[model samples]
Target: MTHHASDIPDSFLAKWQTTTNVLAGIFDVPAGLIMRVLPGQIEVLVSSHSEGNPYEADEKAQLNTGLYCETVMATRALLHVPHALEDTHWEHNPDVALNMVSYLGVPLLWPDKEVFGTICVLDSKKRNYQDKYVELLWEIKKSIERDFVVIEQQRQLLENNAELQAALQRLTALQDELLRSEKLAALGAVVAGISHELNTPIGNSLLAASTLQCHAADFAVDMKQGLTRSRMLDFVSTVEQGAGILMRSLDQAAKLVGSFKQVVDDQSAADRRRFDLGEMVRSVLSELNHTIQGSGHRVHCAIAPGILLDSYPQQLAQVMTHLVSNAVQHAFLPGVAGTVRIAAQPDSEGQVVLTVRDDGLGIPQANLGRVFDPFFTTRLGRGGSGLGLHIVYKLVTAALHGSVEASSEPGQGACFTVVLPLSAPAPLQKPEVRAVRNGNFV
Candidate 1:
């Protein structure tokens, strides 16, 4: 909070000294000085040399009633006396004792309005300082203040950089935690769906087995009472019916288990291999069949077969699953019949465009843009975690090195198009340079 002119750097002192030399030469004064305000004294930080120059650099003077600098500091104004001996009030000033009777000075101020000192010139003979001289001194003072401005700016910049770094650190930690929470939530939802789907088929198979056991006991009793031809025929028909039910139930259970296992395995595995895009899409549909089972919505795929990719198939599978699931949950109203169509093809640019479109109550025009933003959902309190589209966006961009966008019109339908390369770009590496011994380096 407390600043003295002595606190100025040596570089600034050197510059001020050069300025004082120029000022004195222009004004043809015997001495020019840059004085600094200390606790109780005015100290000369720089002095200009001319013939008969009585003041030297680093000379100290008291700021009492008799000195011209004292008057400038007291009023915070310029003090100009053509000749101290001619002015009745300044005839006995301390400078008069050194035979320097003329004086011109202006008060210097720090950025905070605190007194720094005075910039002044003195003459051994009677001489007046012109307006041009005063103007020149003002310019020199401005140069010194400019340096102070730079110092303050650098200080604030350092402080702001520290705050920015701290904020970035906090954001990184939150992002990690959010990623963990989203994974757990997605896993929980998948497990619940798989459980629900397996329950029906397995439960039906158990019921049919119980019934078959009861029928067998009834036949044993009828045999002990001496079996009839009609009874025997009826028992054979009943046995055939029960066996058919058991077979269908068990078969359904096995198919559900296989589909669920395949989806879970693909999502967890990150292996990259050659795969057919059309087949991959159909596999994803099988896994999501349970989601749209009774929702009156059907998924149709028109992927170009033999369109192979050497990318992360599992991640692509997850992307397809989310796209279809989003359509089932958000594109249609309850009990409404609609069709979700997925089409994939290679474009002229060697990029594959996969589009998932729906014919249902489409998204509102206003919400189309924000649908991919994290935690942005119209069904917040319902079953929406609001992370599905956000996850899709990230996977397509970061993991797949692709881009995705959505377009929708209310009541017309919504479509999400993902554009990806058949193979991601290779990572950058430093180039190798070989020296050729023949004639020149290559």
Candidate 2:
């Protein structure tokens, strides 16, 4: 990692300052310094508190100026100048002007083998530093390198956490989008079913009306020719029969339309209201009638009456729709008959237990626990998006503040039970993703 002088914490710098002060006292030098390497410059990061030390902390000098610390950094090795005035090569170096003739310094390197700077002692008089002194400086260099390792690790950890957070946000966005699409798809299917169902009654009414129109015109023509008593009686009987058929057909159509309108309004608006549990379930089942009939499955609702709830009716309807739809789509085989039963009852704890059970092929034991997971479907490419149960799980737990569980016995049937409070809690600002264990949310 690239680092700057300012990146060094003050705590570490304080420790280095103490080290420099001790070194200066031991060496009896005028200056004991820890330098940091920068672009085209070298800085005195820590300077000793020894009396008469010329270099102060944070002092900078241009690099490649024949400075003793610069040479140590360039070679990444030790440089010991016993006497600068005595050596012709260093006689005109910058330290000579400061009257510092003797130098002993070691290069400091980071864990990545990059230059940090140098640690050294400078004496005003010529002195030959001992081997023990050089070894002690090398020990201090090792300690500083260890500090570099810790800093780099912390930097990498922070970067990794940021990346994980970003990925989680992205996953949440995609899940929301998929959830919306699934709802639209479900709504569209209901519309198609209702349209198909409306065809029969509307067609019957039209046929009856047309037949009555022809009979009325024939009666008028017969009236001009002096109609007989038996003919007039037949005309009155025909009119009565036609009127009854029209009333029944129109009444049936109106009922279907009313049920459709209520279900659609509740689901689309998603408004919270007090409603009868049995009535709501019947409405939802009415909308899903076409789907159940198409699958050759019979639905028997045994919901108790007078069980009212103050909650989001739309979300509850969705839960019912998906659960019933799941049973119809997965429970039976081709040309095989099955029964899906919905039952609900109110408990003493002001809660309701709603169940959807199918008497068809049951879920396998191994796959039972993972049925609620998103994008997990046995019928992958055969018209299953796999979000059906997942959405149901989210709605019950997060929005409705309830719990759902799935149970099955192989070759018998599958059952989904949902327990919800009579009054739902306040809605959350955002849906929470929860873990499911053993086919139930804990």
Candidate 3:
């Protein structure tokens, strides 16, 4: 029968031998055997010294201890048998055919609070069993129990250590994910800054190109009509103007390229220094003069003298570009032009507020809050990465330690205001972009 010791972590078959010869002599048997009851099986640990047939170790015998150990364990009784062949409790056992006649078995209750098995003695001759010999077996059972407890405790300790190791692995994975998120946020902010810095010079070049193109078209007409000396000189003048335009455009372009290059290099390099905010914004807007005129929109700017920031300039450029471009692209529609005002002024407290105002189709109140969310774009598929405002938010909050807000009404136009801290922003542990942008119905 299945028993607790067979499956219990603390249970095991132990040989408690205290002079087997003396044990056999005292028990008046040929063999002194110890068998432990385990779950679904039994283990034979010790066998007595015999003169006749030696009982080999059981390799495949289930404790198959029917009601026997149960009765003795429940009652704590000593089993005394004169002859196994005639005993009603064990006559059916195959051991009866062997020279075994006397069977005295006692349940071993160890002192350490575990049941190792049962101790028994078998004799070829039928002999009356006694209590004194059974009492000696109990003493031996108690001794082995002490050792079992020590070993079992160690096994439990090992299991606990293994569990702790698994928990540490899980914790490490979570920490890695957190680190990755932080890096991605930083990357978004840098992109925003770079976008801002590029807008100005490119805009200036575009204006210069347009002015030269208009002048060249006039000279082209004169050349096509006739090759007069006056026309030739006029053509030369036109060529010189175009060359100057090209040179200016190229120079502005070089500055933009250099700025972008430094930003890219910083990704694989070390820390960068702060930049002049007022200068960067002013330089960028100079290039956009032509675009403003082409779109029939006027730009009114009031940049503070010493507005400055401590951060990667490229990322800050991106933030400004997205905001300004958004104002340009969506500022005017339906034969109606608008005014875009860019102002930067430091308050008495030294905090700088940059405002971009557009008098075009103002944002709807409902959608104003969601524009900055990643992948949330009102433009459908029209060159909108849905990342514009998202990138802006990331830069302002993460890199600049600044806050941005917008207010608008239908037909009244919209205004975006960003407030930057006077000093360098403290690094944040978990920087995330805020959602902004929506439709305003008039």
On lDDT, the leading prediction is 2
* lDDT value, candidate 2, whole model: 0.82
Candidate 1 Cα errors over 4 Å, as ranges? 1-22, 36-38, 43-68, 75-102, 106-116, 124-271, 286-294, 334-336, 345-350, 364-412, 424-442
For candidate 2, give the lDDT of residue 353. Answer: 95
lDDT of each: 0.76, 0.82, 0.64
Q: Give the clashing pairs for model 2.
A: none
RMSD in Å for all candidates: 10.8, 8.0, 13.5
Candidate 3 backbone clash number: 32
lDDT of 2 by residue, 346-385 (tens): 8899899999999989899987876776555676544454
Worst 10 residues of 2 by lDDT: 260-269
Write one digit per residue (lDDT tens) for candidate 1, span 1-442.
2444436667777887788888789889888888887777878888986677888887898767478888888898888899888889999989999998998888877777777778888988888767887888788777766766765576569789999999999999999788667646644664565566567778888888898899899999989999999999998998899889889988977865654343222132237678889999999888888887867788999897998887778778878988898888888877678899999889888789999999988888887876775445676445454556766766576556688999987667889999999986542321111101110111
Write model 3 residue lDDT over 85-202, tens digit each, in one string: 6777777665666667666777766545456566667777777745666678777655555656665676669779999999999999998787566446644654554454445556
Clashes of each: 0, 0, 32
Could you say which candidate leads in TM-score? Answer: 2
Which sequence of candidate numbers ranks them by TM-score, best first? 2, 1, 3
